[model samples]
Target chain A: MNWHEAPDMRNWILLLLLLLEIATFTFLSGVRFDSAGDFTAYFQSYLGDLITQSTPTLLLAFGMTLVLITAGIDLSVGSMVALVGCIMASFPGNTEFWWTAVPLGLLTGLTLGFLNGALVAWLDVPPIITTLGTMIFYRGLCFVVMGDLEKAPFITVPGYEWLGIFSGVIVMLGLLYLIGGPYVYHSRWLRELFMMGGNRIAARYAGIPVQRRTLQVYTLIGFLGFLAALSFTARNSSISAGSLQGFELQVIVAVVLGGTRVQGGSGTLLGAFLGVMLIAVLEEGLRGASIWGDTYLPFEISHLEYIFLGALLLIGVWVSNIAHQRSRA
Target chain B: MIHGRLDYRHRRRIYFLLAGNLLLLGLIRVLLKEGSSFAEVLRRAGPDVAPVILAGLAMTSVIFVGAIDLSVASIIAVAGSAFGVLVHHDQPPWICYFACLAAAWVLSMWNGYLIRTLKIPAIIVTLAGLPFYRGLALIVADLGIPDFGGNISVYDAAYHQPGKFYAGWILLATIIAALIWEAFGRTPRQWLARGNSEEACRLLGMKPERILQSAFCAAGIFLGFAALIAVTRLQAIEPGRMLVGFELHIVGAVVLGGTNIFGGEGSFGGTILGAFFLYFISQALTYAGASAYFQEAITGAVILAVIGLDCAIHRRQKQLDELA
Candidate 1:
């Protein structure tokens, strides 16, 4: 029950879930090969598609895991993505110009994130209500800025396609794993996030500077949202107010499925990374099977993905609860 | 010094609540003067505002227990969609209505069970239920039930009467509920207990879980009835759009009516006034030639402003309490 005690059972469950996900993907993909000629092609393309679609979610969930570990939720991430994507797409395409556009978009996102942080940290607003208000406000701004128009040309820029495609996802995941993993595991300032989430008043009394840390956490989430926006825009080659609709929910779902407690205190970014992959694989695999598919249902699978995700989240929570109960007992 | 301080504190609290109500009434008057016929306006506003008032009432109950129901809108959607499908299948209207209500009640009970027994946070439980209910609604919609006719007006005698007179009925019900609650609903005692500390409530042998469960169940029933009124009035259900963001509106109303979002202190009367204030503003904006988009922005602003005001009042009260 102590903070440093490893949640062995939850970790094992996470591994099992990941394995089950891979198996499901394999089975759903039909595992076809005609004399091995098409085997690598089908396999690579399927894996590539899964990685590509999941990149943004993975990045968002990565940051979300940390935020949730601090016992705070960011409902504004999706709106931040839309706002940042719109800003990036509004710029005329030129590889040389992306340096400016991307940074500017990130700054805008960071500023919005800081606003969220300030509200919660300084103004004493609850995270849920503060983020809820910002969610509406930011999305409204997006609509106002974009005029509700869906811009397609910016996404199709030369060299930009890689951002939405598999290569970009892999690169982003790699960089995060390199940077975020160590910062979380090794640093004192960073580790306090879990302690703060575990018990804010105690952490505050312990000189953990709860308010400042909370602000930093939300601001970082906003920055990650900017990165996700870049990836998403590059992939779809389109930007609209509706671009990342319902995305925040997906990120939260992924985080929870990864076994992060909503009440905060403990979680691993690695679990979130794997969680995104699991969801992506499930969707892609279900699609490849063509059992029942529709435009709304990943275009290649049935609407069952939603139900499946919900069930997974519930089961994950239940299992963790049981583990916690038993550990306490 | 103590006597004077107590007198000042009591007067200040009364003044604050009165000022909030007066500001809302002023907004209503401004809305009433805008374009529509006075009589037609009342008729239209009645049905349109009824669900919000009812839902706000329901939300108030949950807020009293310091919990929120994000899934209420989805419940409305599911119930509306289910009713649409059943009625389409030539099922008796009464049967279809009851079934929808029953389903919503059961789902809410499930939420209560999860929060109480499983000890899940109310926000997380309701957040999950929000999507689950939406998915259920969508699935039911896609099951090949015929769409309710566009602009189909329900003229069923029984349904028409409720739609026509429900506003007054809601008002009466709200007054009765508030009186009953104030007199015997354990408000003063629970507030005293929760305000002291949750630990103190347990030490005093209060069954917090039972209280919360009952509150959620009651909210579920209220929401079901609100959904029924909305669908019956439309005479055709569009689950896709029926109560989208309706929960936010209810929350806004509750908060504006002076209910503490953090819980324990609120009034049903204030909530009724809050609902009327919102309905009036929307009606006014339309009459003033504002677009629906502007109306939404205004509503959002109103919600923020009300919450902001509540925060100020709460801070002042805390200061006074400390001073005492």
Candidate 2:
């Protein structure tokens, strides 16, 4: 394969970008370490905080990879997260809240995902239109449920904050990416998803249960949304109807930036991990470099994150697409 | 596919939307206060509803060519920001409006150009544009105006002409022209042909990519008017928050109008009816004394129910065709 054609080459480039981002940000932010012990502790705390804070986005990105791999997109994941959190937070902050609200949130998430699946699989509505409708519908429901109130019942719930820390990030992401990812990467089920994405008719003709698999994939995302809600609420400790208005874009950008074919049929979980870290670092770096920006630039440095993100997405997808075509030739 | 017959369901959908609009109008009539004039309500509906209608028309043209522009709200925001910046610079009103129109047209064409050259799907391109353009708007505002606040207030009456005084005329003229062009012009037929199957269009000796680009070009004209009306109607243009979630509403209305979401099988006439139907639904609810908070949820439900049922009704035919 040509250097540009190899998937390994693509990932290496992403790794390069990540390192470049970190080094530049560190320099611009002008932080210095005086001692090895101090450096180690700072590293530990910063990594922990970064991973924990972005847990909601990371969890959503995992499901998004599966969805995109199957040639479907979910515009409603952001709304789904908010709706789940809103529903769960409406309950009184007591031990009973966990038992009642948690179950309800799970049920709601699964049901919402099922709705999207049914629309796509059964009614034959295109996934974009179906989810676009449901996105608005779900966001509307969030408002109806919580009105203007920002509820934080999770803050008062005992032991819930555990999910917001490094330990929680380890368990949740490990289960999805570390364990389940490899399993799916090698499974016949994964092959089926790729087949469906490549061409739906051929997959159906090959005796794949198209509707069932579609439903399962979508509902699985819903369950992931439930987990995301848990992580987000634990960290942020409050929820509103519009809490994550543009969140689906972030997750989609990360997954797409990972070199997942938007046209479907090919992706790797490892690539997705790199994609997430790259974006997360850029975001954090831009934020941290505000002191540098205050004097040098007119606009806020943090605002530049949007421009970088858009540029990154366009460039990332364009390169990955070229790679995909070149490798085939 | 280039010569595929129009779907009966799409034809029926137009009638359904028409009926829905009439029925909602009746409800609004019945619920109106004793002293209020139904004539006034009818007259005011045009300017109030033109933004969505115009935007839906733009979306319809794009979807007709198997593409979607999710960056519409962002495009409008950028246009609005351009208008605001120009206004703040004390440019004439016509110049400001023209700048707004031109900015929208250029960005829309840029979306077309990128999709064509890069061979990326329209959805992905515009999805990126959604944020990129909004940020561009804010940055433009921040740099262009001194001591820029979040929003720029347009206090001049002349600045509001397109959205306030001439919106109805602009909408009517555009719709009439669009419907006529769609019915009689070769370009629109080419768009439908390209939408049906780009490969087929190519084999037929038509430039499918050019056809697609032309569709976007045409959509830019309609979108220019949409941005003009949407921007000029507002007393203040806030680049960050303006038209937030407006793209979804336009998409919903377009889809609801019986246009196929994937493109190649819908009418501009149906889109007009769909937009009116949605507007009247909200009007009826307001007149019926429903809470404002419930209105958005109800609009969403209506979109889901209408589109879901329509898709379901068409499923049998789709399955037969696929299995064959």
Candidate 3:
């Protein structure tokens, strides 16, 4: 009945949904089974690829989780990542990438994030409107920088491709979820964030320094966006002005699916992690089932991804609310 | 009479929009080639900016009741797909137009109902609707038409009449009707009142929920026209890509017109001028030979600058009130 119990119960539901998804997709994709060992190997690689391919989304979802916890949304993360990637791509792909483009990309991410923070915190613009404007502005800047070009400098960077692989993603996930998440779970700072989200006016009156927290949260999203850009470019090996379109929605949906309330006040890092995997699994599963879909369905199998994503988001929120109300009742 | 009829707050915004409109007009006139007449520019304005204007009007009501519909673009896509499918079947113009308008109206009303009944925030509902409607459009297209390609192209000139020729008339008539309604009608004021204080409206025997729903219905009517013009103007209806990010432009225009983003105060005249101001800025950039890439950046900057300035100007007053 308490907050702690409510989330755990929701997590159980999510895990069950995730299991159902995996079962359905595995059957649809028609898993090959020559032997037990071969089947295990196939499953392991499939899972690894899903996680690795979704690393950027996972990293951004971590930040988005915290942002939504503060009752704010960042609509510019996609544009921010694209801008950072586009900026990094302007440099040559060589050993010098470490010294030249990497730091600059971080700074770009920080500066852009700070601008969003300032608008929302100091200028008092609503987070959604401010980010909406910056989203277009940053995207436009990407076009100006790249000029309708796609750059693949990331592929030529020394050892950079490692970051896009399974091991690198696993390391990032370990740091973010296993280590950093627990650190946040007990941190007074995050508690203060929840307080602010619950009631900004009361928190301010209670000496929470609301503006500073707002600025910090947005700036944090920006920093995470930089990391996301690194993972994305390293994996995809290409950057274009139009890259990562609709990516913010994907991250938000994943976090929301993981049981983070959009109204803020409560969230769990583990929940977001599960949420991202849920979507990633669905995506990869759909792609894997393309043959089956082509034979059975009337439309492209991938087209169903959009419908599923939307439906799952609505259903997730709807289910979570029902659970919340039942607990209170 | 005009001075006596308006509040000091709205009077200031009206004057500001008028000055901005004049400035943009002069800038455009200067940028045009030597022989080009101002009349020619004006003539093209209505059709070119009809969609944004109508959508802005649609947003104004929803915003007036302190809600937003981010799914307008997606709704337009669905409507456009329906229109396209009908056209592909060689349906009469009235049937196609009716289908398009009906789709948009029904979606808007559905959104309103969902927001009311589900007790969810409009933003969250519509954020979900954004993808849901887009995917729905694609599904509708796929199921309705056999041998569906990605796009449905309407080659007949007759189908384009509403967008190409009648758009100007539709826009003008709508503006006049909106102005008259805003000035004298009860519904618009009810929206503003509900926006101003939902609790107070309830205390006054007004149902805020019903008021919000009515605002959405009015918005749906405007959105129907917007979808009609928007779809007709396009030679091809590609549901996957149709009207992506169109909601931002509408929001920008509505905000630029001095409509409160939180609702409670706005005018149709201001939205009309605001939409024109934005259109002229892009047109001026084209005439001045600015790079195509700069158009979006300029528009974003302009929206940010206007909204930021307005917010800053009011911040001191808000702070003063808080202190009091």
Q: Which segments of candidate 2 are over 4 A away from where they belong?
A: A3-5, B1-5
Give the per-residue lDDT digits (tens) of candidate 3, residues A107-168. 99999999998998888787777888888888889988998899999999999998899998
Candidate 2 residue pairs that clash:
none
Considering summed lDDT, which 10 consecutive residues are worst modelled in model 3 chain B?
B1-10
lDDT of 3 by residue, B111-184 (tens): 89988888777877787888889988998898888877888898998899889889999998998999889888
What does each candidate score in C-alpha RMSD?
Answer: 4.9, 2.0, 2.0
lDDT of candidate 1 over B1-324, digit per residue (tens): 212322343334335546655664455556665473566766666567777887787788778777778788888878777776666666777887787778678778888888888676676677677667776776676663533332223445554344455755754675576547655666534642453366767788887777777777877877777777766666656655567556766777777676666676666666777777767766666766665555554665666555555455566565466557
Candidate 2, residues A1-329: lDDT per residue as tens digits? 57666677878888998888988997898789899997788768867877887888888888888888889989899999999999998998888877899999999999999999999999988888788888888988998898988988887898899888789878999998889988988899988999999999999999999999999889988999999999999889999987999788888888888888777887777788888888899888988899999879887667677778878888888877887777777
Report lDDT (Cα) of residue B17, candidate 2.
89
| Every model's DockQ | 0.25, 0.66, 0.63
Local error of candidate 3 at residue A262 (angstroms): 2.4
Q: Is candidate 1 or candidate 2 better by DockQ?
A: 2
Candidate order, DockQ descending: 2, 3, 1
Fnat of each prediction? 0.06, 0.55, 0.50
In candidate 3, the residue pairs with backbone N, CA or C atoms under 3 Å apart (3 or more residues apart, or in different chains) clash, namely: none
Q: How would you encode candidate 1's per-residue C-alpha lDDT over A1-329 as one tens digit per residue?
A: 44224665556657787778777667655575676768778767867887778888988898899889988888778888998887777777776546877789999889988988987776666676677667766776676567758887664466777777777778887788777677667889667999988988778778998889988888988888888887888777788875676778888888887878988997877778767777777776666667424433432234456557766777667767777776667
Q: How many clashing residue pairs appear in each of the predictions shown?
A: 2, 0, 0
